[model samples]
Target: MTLTPQDRTIVEATQAGLPLVTRPFAVVAESLGLSEAELIDRLKQLKAQGVIRRIGAAPNHYRLGMTANGMTVWDVDDAVVDSLGEKVGALPFVTHCYRRPRALPDWPYNLFAMVHGETREEVIAKRVEISSLLGKACRAGDILFSTRILKKTGMRLRGKEG
Candidate 1:
């Protein structure tokens, strides 16, 4: 999408992430020489125009004492996968969940949900809870624990080189 010069400036100013201060928008707006209200309005407009998907915090799960992270994969019956996925995603321990296309032959899991806890055993217990919820709809499943942390960040706008 084509962003206006001003919108581009706003995106560039905040893409690295908003300030960790109490008044983050205000800080960004000040840096852009715009009022906080104007910055917020423009952001809302950008979202409406599909230029921005969402603005949210990406917390560090490990820092929050949730060191054990497991991505549970399930071979769910396609007929009810979507409906069942919604239920699995809503679980308290599930940090994120979605459906993926099955690889077949080698990999047949079509549903994935991430669970986090203080330990691997805790994560496994949460996986059991998910399995119970899936019941007969889930045929096979497995859990992959995270070995290392990865940096996460939002989209960034590149500046024009004159």
Candidate 2:
């Protein structure tokens, strides 16, 4: 996509993250020497053009007492995976859930969900809850916890803007 100079300015200014304030857009606009309305309108236009998918905050769950994080993998029937995935994704404790291709003969898990807790036991309890929800559809499941914390960063738009 050919991004206008203003679009590039907006993306560069807010790509790091929106300001933590009552009027973040206004602050951003001031930085670019643009009006608040102009900044908001440009954002709406960007969304309409599909240049940006969505904007939201990603909180650090570990710092919030959720030290134990695990990605629970499930081997479910392909026929019912879509419905099952939707149900799992809607779960409050499930931060993220999605379907993935299974590598048979060696690996077989096709469904994945990420859940967090303060300890491994808590994460296991949450896994049990997920298993119960999956019921017989859950052919097999396992949780993979991280030994070290991972940093999450936003995507970067490379190259100079048009």
Candidate 3:
């Protein structure tokens, strides 16, 4: 979605984070020189137009003792990936799971799963459990452990509106 000048500014400001206060939106409004109601209305309009999906926290899982986050890639039967993907996605430890095209000549993994744990051992165990959950439909996969935290945020105003 194309952003209005106001929308662009608000989104950029909040991308860093919401203010820590009882009235975070009011702080945003003050910084933008807009009334709280006006700021909220613009946000509402953005949501209605599907420019913004959801406003939520990008929790620091590592700092919260979840130091190991494994990006588990899977090779699964296309027919059953969807139903099983939903089950995997619903897992609290599995922060994300989605199907992508089978990796090309250089890439082999297609189904992606994200599982967070307190240690590498725990993360691997989670993957083993996932494998059992998938049963025969799951062929093979690999686990990539996260070592550092990059920036995380909500929707971007620049591209890929969703």
The local distance difference test score of each candidate is 0.92, 0.91, 0.84
Tens digits of lDDT, candidate 3, 1-162: 568777889888677678889999999999999999998898888888887776777778767999888899988888999998998888778988999998577767778999999889999999998888888998788899887767565445563356
| lDDT minimum window of 10 residues, candidate 1 | 148-157
Candidate 3 lDDT: 0.84
Superposition TM-score, candidate 2 onto the true structure: 0.84
> Candidate 1's residue-wise lDDT over 4-68, tens digit each?
99989988887888888999999999989999999999999999998887899877888999999
TM-scores for all candidates?
0.86, 0.84, 0.83
For model 1, state the Cα shift of residue 11 in Å.
3.0
Alpha carbon RMSD to native, model 2: 2.5
For candidate 3, the 10 contiguous residues with the lowest summed lDDT are: 153-162
TM-score of 3: 0.83
lDDT of 2 by residue, 1-162 (tens): 899988988988888799899999999999999999999999999999999877888788867999899999999989999999999999999988999999986789999999999999999999999999999988999999978865577787565648
Error of 2 at 124 (Å): 0.7
lDDT of 1 at 117: 95
TM-score of 1: 0.86
List runs of model 1 lying over 4 Å from the truth: 1-5, 48-53, 154-162
Highest TM-score: give the candidate number: 1
